[model samples]
Target chain A: MYKVKVYITLRESVLDPQGAAVQQSLHSLTYNEVSDVRVGKYVELTIKDTDRDLDQLVKEMCEKLLANTVIEAYRYDVEEVITQ
Target chain B: MYKVKVYITLRESVLDPQGAAVQQSLHSLTYNEVSDVRVGKYVELTIKDTDRDLDQLVKEMCEKLLANTVIEAYRYDVEEVITQ
Candidate 1:
């Protein structure tokens, strides 16, 4: 089996209103050192072993379902899981 | 400056319906090799240099505002950013 960690974030050119709100809230609560904030999604997937290429499968899933590629970019790390 | 990456995830005991929905969607799209899924939040913060301990400050923010400690757990990584 494999464990996949995927992170999807807004593209550099895109605006992230939610992140701005969080930053403002932090400032209100006196965390003024925070200068910028960006909010994104993190997904963990446990996959059974497969003959198909793992990276290709993950990319396909991210493109087709996990991420809105028009405004978001995604990257993933895959780890092998040892099962007894 | 420092770049802080925070990941907030539901505790293992809590059920994740959103993750289940995504997994179902993936199965419908024929990615049958996936066995489990969990969805979480990723927040990136750009922090100005401060005398306060960086890790403590981040942990405080996560406990006070960034994460719902009742149902979620958060972890962070801080990397120093050099400005030329």
Candidate 2:
């Protein structure tokens, strides 16, 4: 099996209102040292071993379903899992 | 400055309905090799230099605002940023 960890975040040019709200909340809570905040999605997928190229498959999955490529960008790390 | 990357995931014992929905969607999209899926939150914080211990400060922030500790578990990675 393989474990894939994917991170999807807004493009650098995009405005992240959710992040801004979180920063504001932190400020209200007196965490004044925080200068900025960006929020994103983290997904973990467990896939059974397959003959298909893993990296290619992951990229296809991200583009087609995991990420909204218009306003968001995604990256992933894949690792093999050892099962007893 | 310090850049902190935080990942908040549901505790292993908790039911993740959002993750289940995502898995179902992926299956419908024909990614049948995927055996399981888990979704979580990824937050990036840009914090101005502080005299406080960075790790402890981040831990406090996670407990106080970033994560709901009752059902979620969080981990963070911190790196120093150099400004020219």
Candidate 3:
């Protein structure tokens, strides 16, 4: 099986309200050293054995559904899992 | 400044309904090879210069707000951001 880790984040040009809220909360907590914050999504997938190119499949998935390419960007890391 | 990347995932024993839904969608897309899915959160924090221990502060933030430690686990990667 293949273990895929996908990270999705807002485009630099986008504003993230959730991140802003968290930053404000940090400041209130006296974590004044926090300069900025951006929230994102992480997705982990375990795939059964497949003959198709894993990278291509993952990219397709990300572009089609995992991420909204219009405002967000995504990248992935794949690992081989050995299960007995 | 420090760019901290935080990853929060549900505990292995926890049930992830969102992940399951995504997996079902993938299956409907003919990506039937997908075996499992887990959805998580990724947070990016830009921290200002501080003499205090960043690692400790990050841990505190994760435990208090970034994650629900009762059912989720979090890990982080810190990077030094160089600005001229």
Candidate 4:
């Protein structure tokens, strides 16, 4: 099996209200030194095969459905997992 | 600085169309053994301070804004980074 890790984040110039809210909460909780907080998403997937061609497949998936390249950016890493 | 990693995934019962599409792509790419694909999100945040109270602050941040606890589930790990 293969494990894929995907990270999605808002475009750098875009304002992240959710992240701002978290920043505010951190300050209120006495973590006043915290100056910024940007929140994003992490997803993990397990696929049943591990072939040389799998990389292209995963990349196509990321482009078509796994990510919205306009508003967000995504990166993924695939690794083979050993089974007992 | 402290680095926070957040993972968000669809609840077990929710159908993940995006993930399904990716799975199909994998099969078409000759990864016929691949049976399932679920997509989620990953976010990373760098906080400016690391005090004993930081744990509580980060948890609150995750609960209120970093994650949608109802439709999604999240877990985070806090680590201190050394500056060169």
Candidate 5:
């Protein structure tokens, strides 16, 4: 089997209210060393077939459904794995 | 400073089209042993201070801005790091 890891995040210029809130909380927690916080997403998947032309398909998926390209960005990595 | 890593993903019941597409790509690549694929997001943030109660703040951030709690879930980890 193969494993895919995906990462999604807002564009750098975008204001991240969620990150700001986390920063504030870190300040309150006595984790005074924390300065800023930005939040994003991570996902992992296992695929059954690996003989297809998955690169183009995955790219299309990112463009069409996985991400809202206008506001977010996504990247993925593929790895081979042993399945039971 | 403190480093915060955030992970966001769709719930189990949600259809992950991006993941499916990637799976197809893997199959084409000759990685035929692959199975199902799920896609998610990952974010890393560097905070200047870490003495505050960041837990509550991060939770609020996740609820209000970091993730769409209705359809997505988020989790985070914090690490202390030295900054120049």
Candidate 6:
């Protein structure tokens, strides 16, 4: 099986209100050194053993549903899992 | 400076409704090979240069807010940023 770890984040040009709120919360917590806080999504996908090209399949999945390319960008790491 | 990438996810024992929803969506899209979808949170923390022990600070942050030890688990990657 293949385990794909996907990370999706708002584009640098996009405003991140949730991030801002978290930043403010941090500031209130006295973690003043923290800045440029950006919040994102982390998705883990487990795919059954298949012959399809993993890269193409993951990219298609990201483009079609995992990520909103218009405002967010996504990247992934794939690892093979051995089932005993 | 340090850039910390944090990934927070529900514990294996915990149920993930968002993940199930995404799994169903993927199935509808005909990605039948996909399974075991888990959804999580991705946070990017930009920390200013400091003399404090980074490992300790990050651990505290995760325990205090980033991860709910009761039901969520978190891991992080820290990268040193060379500011020119």
How far residue A23's Cα lies from its native spot in candidate 5, in Å, is 1.4
Give the TM-score comparing model 6 with the true structure, all chains together: 0.97
DockQ of 5: 0.41
Model 1 ranges off by over 4 Å = none
On DockQ, the candidate that comes out on top is 1
Q: Over all chains combined, what TM-score does candidate 5 have?
A: 0.58
Clashes of each: 0, 0, 0, 5, 54, 0
Native-to-model Cα distance after best TM-score fit, residue A38 in candidate 6, in Å: 0.4
Q: What lDDT score goes with residue A51 in model 4? A: 50
Q: Which of 5 and 6 is ahead in lDDT?
A: 6
Residue B75 CA displacement from its true place in model 3, Å:
0.3
For candidate 6, write residues B1-84 as lDDT tens digits: 899999999999999999999999999998989987999999999999877888888888888877799999999999999999
lDDT of 2 by residue, B4-62 (tens): 99999999999999989888988898888998899999999999999888888899999
How should the candidates be ordered by DockQ, best one leading? 1, 2, 3, 6, 4, 5
lDDT of 4 by residue, B1-84 (tens): 777776778888888898788777766766666666767766666877654577776677667765677877766777887887
What's model 1's TM-score?
Answer: 0.99
lDDT of 4: 0.72
Top candidate by TM-score: 1
| Candidate 5 lDDT tens digits, A44-83 | 7565564566676566656765568898888888786776
Strongest candidate by lDDT? 1
Residue B14 deviation, candidate 4, in Å?
A: 6.7
Q: Rate the local accuracy (lDDT) of all candidates.
A: 0.97, 0.94, 0.95, 0.72, 0.69, 0.93
- How far residue B2's Cα lies from its native spot in candidate 4, in Å, is 2.1
- Give every collision pair in model 4: A41-B41, A41-B42, A41-B43, A42-B41, A42-B42
The better-scoring model by TM-score among 1 and 5 is 1
User: By DockQ, is 1 or 4 better?
Assistant: 1
Clashing pairs in 6: none
Question: lDDT per residue, candidate 2, A5-38, as tens digits?
Answer: 9999999999999999999999998899999999
Return the TM-score for candidate 3, rounded to 2 decimals: 0.98
lDDT of 1: 0.97
